[model samples]
Target: MNERSLVFFVIVLLCAGFMALSSFEMVQDYIKPASGRSVILNHLMKLTVALVFFVVFLYTDHRMLFSRPVIVGGYVLSIALLVVVLILPGGETRTHRWMNLGYFSFQPSELVKIYTILFLAWYVEKNQLFMKRLFRGFLKPLLLVSPFLFLILVEPDFSTFALLFLTVMLTLYVAETRGVYVLTFFSIALIFFVYTYRMGMLNNILRSYQIERLVSYLKGNVSEQVMRAVEAIRSGGTVGKGMVLGEEKLFVPVVTSDFILAIVGEELGYIGLGVILFSFYGLVHSLVKVVSRMQPIPSVKTFISGFAILIMLQVMVNVGVVSGIFPVTGVTLPLVSYGGSSLLATMIGFGIVGNMILESERE
Candidate 1:
């Protein structure tokens, strides 16, 4: 691989390693299997599936994959999967977001994130002139995104829905859509939020547990979960409790998924967390620099910058939620979360960004 490719690969490896370590802790804490073999097998299964997708993403031609028909077909497939998961029978926790396939359960909402990004990128790239049309220009993109957003919201995956909405808005803004149109959309979103709150529609839309989580945040009631997270960080102190010895892992649910950063903070301490954050910040900075340097290729530049912003935004929101600075939204820390679909989708997105950067360099 070239130097840039090497840098990308190193970053991916670092992320994957962090996630794998977190997953191991979760499995140990939660999954009490009859034998050590079974535990190892489960871990291997998850890691292998993620690795397979990572390889596929690394090899795939992102530009060709972003074509109109391909994008539409991907959206259709993602929605179909979501429907299938909703209809399938499983225990309450598993049934809500996953589809069982003998040995594994997959989350459709995870895949939907990638498909939505692909669709938005393709749409915005093709409609550069619409950026000047104000309200008329936004109609097409809005139409394309509306159904997807509705489906995701119905899935009760509001965190992913928020990410999708942010991605669309960012892509549109970067495409040079008028400020008034952007403001108009934000106004509409605010109005919708108020309507939902006043009508108790928000309560209907979110599950009781979800609503409680929101209430806990709004009321400034630090939940047991948040308290446990805080305790984890405190236990870590300056140097951390030293990996698997950390007590926080035993108390925190979904620590390997949504709140994995807390584990890092608990075991690796603030220094390790700071390193991870700095790496991500550096990645975002490099991406922005790449975009700015590509003045000769405005379309590609806009697309890359918008895409990078979407990724960074999700990261920030997820981190903020975990840190108790924002409402808990079920947003997983990108790259560092132990979900197969998320890992694959993120690799694919970064692959596309890398492709854009490479093309720019070639020019």
Candidate 2:
């Protein structure tokens, strides 16, 4: 690999290493009581899956794969998968976010985020002049996005839907779409949000337990879920409780996924949390640098900026949820969270970013 690719690979490896260590710590604390060897193996298997996907994505030709037809096909496939997920039985706590295949579960909404970015990029590149117009150019992208958004909401995966919406908005803004057009879109979204909530659409779409989780969060009741997360962070204190010493791991729901930040806060403490945040900031900085240097290719630059903002926004939202600054939305902590699909999707996104940087460098 070239120096740039090597640097990108190193960063990805560091992220994976951190997540694996956290997962191991959780397993030792929670699962070891019943079967230590089995717990270790399970965590190792997850780590292996993530690593394998990362390696595969690193070797793939991102530029060729992100072509218009492939991007559109990906969107169609993602929607079909989302439909399949909705039809599948035994989703986590009644949330239709995954399709279980005995050995593993796949979340189609994660893949939707990727295809949305690709499609928007292609759309803006082809309609650069039209993009300067207000409604004809700007609002038209929403027509394509609306169906995906509607499908996600129907699946009752509000958190992912929200993230996806925000990502598209950011992409449009960076693509130089009119600001007033975005404001108008936002107004419409707000109206939809109010209408959905008032008409009990969320309740009809989401499971009762899922609704309860959101209610508990909004009420600040500190449900068993929230308390466990708090205990985990508290245990970390200044330095940390040390790996595998966290008491909260056994009780924290989705400890390896949405709640992974709590484990990191507990095991690595405030300093470790700082380091994690710093690494994310550094990654965003690198993306911005790439954008600045690739001014000649405005389309690519816009895409990179949009992608970076979207990823960083998710990271920030995840941290906020864990820190109690925002209601828990079940959003994974990007690379730090467990799950094969999430890891693979995120790595693919980063690979595309790397490709943009490489293409800029070649020019």
Candidate 3:
């Protein structure tokens, strides 16, 4: 990374850490003492784990993961975890997105998302010569990625599933997959999605709350959470209510997770939000520059491009939901959200990207 890019990343990381601390303080009143866990403690533990992943990936050889066996193993392991989460009993919300261990909960969809990107990149590079062919290039890649998407969709993680699917398609396009074939596949998929929704097939898969949320969004009946989030942001005006001083945050549920931006808006105002937006743009711009200038390693370039897309997509979705432009997709802001699974996965991907960039520069 260049000096300027490093500065941008550090700014966002510091901002995220500060916001997380403030969020922890805000939620303390609601956390039960009998629960044996504190929000701050969980955030710190997860941040520690994320930092460890960052260091490990930074030092490790990126080529190790480029091996066929290693890529396949990682992909299979992600799939297995996704499947296991479905069979295990869900927590109080009855959402099958998490696997509750004794001390921590892991969201398998997060793992699946990163692994799928790596796997697709490797697969496309390995078959680049035949990538224009219908079966060998287009259909086959989609077929391989289908299981991962299906598992995540069944986990009822629609946002992750959709974003992952989009990322996979983008990777293929970057690796020289035929544009016609890719477009045809996307068209067919869209038709299938609409057909299923009309037939009520999706009703069986989506949870009651998920269905209700979508319906409310479609019918113009915005949910209370979204209303509160918008209200909080609008109430901030030009200057914020000041850090930890906003009364609106008290009414917004999931303020620390999906709607964390609302807190940023309310506490820090437009200046804080503008800083975050610029920082994200800088980070992604830096990554894209690295990908574009790197030596002709299709897999590495594709992976980094997909990673950038993933980050931007999540940020946009989170912002949209908070502003009531989009429905609540339960998508958290990249690096800004309060979940261990999300933070760890993003850091690990960053580590891989850093290693690849360094390796390319050395070559």
Best by TM-score: 3
Evaluate model 1: give its TM-score: 0.86
lDDT of each: 0.69, 0.72, 0.81
Clashes of each: 0, 0, 0
Task: List model 2 lDDT by residue over 58-128, tens digit each.
Answer: 56666666577787777788778888877877455765778776767778888788778877877887788
lDDT of 3 by residue, 12-105 (tens): 7556655745654664554523355666677878888988999899889988888988987887898889889989987676768887777888
Which prediction has more favorable TM-score, 2 or 3?
3
Candidate 3's TM-score reads 0.93
Q: Total clashes, candidate 1?
A: 0
After superposition, candidate 1 runs with Cα above 4 Å error: 1-47, 90-95, 295-299
Candidate 3: stretches off by over 4 Å: 1-7, 23-36
Compared with the true structure, model 2 gives a TM-score of 0.87
Give TM per candidate.
0.86, 0.87, 0.93
- Candidate 1, residues 299-342, lDDT tens digits: the string is 56655666677768878997787778888767776767666667
Query: Candidate 3: deviation at residue 22, Å?
Result: 2.3
